[model samples]
Target: MANSPQPPLDALYQEALATFDTLLSQARGEGDPEPTAMTLASVEGARVSARIVLLKGVDARGFRFFTNYRSSKGEQLAAHPQAALCFHWKTLRNGVQVRVEGRVATLEAAESDEYFATRPRASQIGAWASAQSQTLADRAEFEARIDEFERRFECVPVPRPPHWGGFVLAPDRIEFWYGADFRLHERQCYERDADGAWSRRMLYP
Candidate 1:
């Protein structure tokens, strides 16, 4: 059978956005506590690392998440601005997977501050107390830091740490996969061109 026609770049992006919204809603309706969680992969030289991070936001611009600027992933991103993200929704009866390859950039101070303000008070304090990806002498040392920050910020809003902020992954390529019977999955892959136009094609499972 012949393949289906692909939509134009802008239209295809809109379709992808709609699909994402549907999948996210479905995931939540199915009782997934963290629907926005995704696997983020970063690399440094030959070393690669992957971790789960909650998606803070997504828009026409890109996907955004926050982390410690001095952490391992932060340093790696500084050296190599490209990274990959994977979202697997297993809560639904029919699983869905989304993959993105993108270039990362730090958000502006104001943007970071705005997002930080929305975080829970404890999380905001933790961001200041924990030196992410750093060695701690002991559990007590970490707890002491948290206590110190808690006391220091008492009766005041915990300010966003200077090293804690948001990063955006502006995707150049994205692939959506839907599971099927007999291992014959459906794949739609989109790639952005030099002129910043997106083109999509279907791929075999």
Candidate 2:
């Protein structure tokens, strides 16, 4: 097979970012929303568990997601304090994979309160009802709890769960990948040195 042309790391990064921005627009217009859902992977004693989660925010600081502070992923991230996030958009044949390693901290009470306020009433009630990652006797029992919470909080705004909050992943490494014709692919990686500066590099496909 012949080697296909590949975009330079910088160019590819810009292209992927542009495509991602367009995708974001489509989601907003359609009111479908970007899955922003990423596969979060955590390592524990050479074992790893991964699950999808909705991303709350992302920027130079890092990506943010909220969940129960005591959930399985939350506990693993707390103990290991490092994880990976992958965003793949099959509809566009594009994906962004980020590797983040940093300490995790629960969001401040004020921040959690503000975010919770923006959630739908049902979501707010569900948060209060669900134990998140804990076992329940049966589906009916869980539904009953949800109904109870709905009744209890009726006409009153649901408060943020004491155990619910968000975490920011300060990425030490960020990798962006793009698909191309044939099997040729483009990869660009950014590494943050001890001095807290980002350096970019290209990788073989």
> How many residue pairs clash per model?
0, 0
Worst 10 residues of 2 by lDDT: 7-16
Candidate 1's residue-wise lDDT over 25-136, tens digit each?
8999998888999999999999899999999888877889999999999889989999999999888766889898989999999999999999999999999999999999
Local accuracy of candidate 2 as per-residue lDDT tens digits, 123-148: 99888888889999999999999999
* Candidate models: Cα lDDT each: 0.90, 0.73
Displacement of the residue 205 alpha carbon in candidate 2, Å: 1.1
Query: Model 1: which ten-residue window has the lowest total lDDT?
Result: 6-15
Which regions of candidate 2 deviate over 4 angstroms?
1-33, 93-103
Off by over 4 Å in 1: 1-9
Q: Residue 50: error of model 2 in Å?
A: 0.5
- Evaluated against the true structure, the overall lDDT of model 1 is 0.90
Best by lDDT: 1
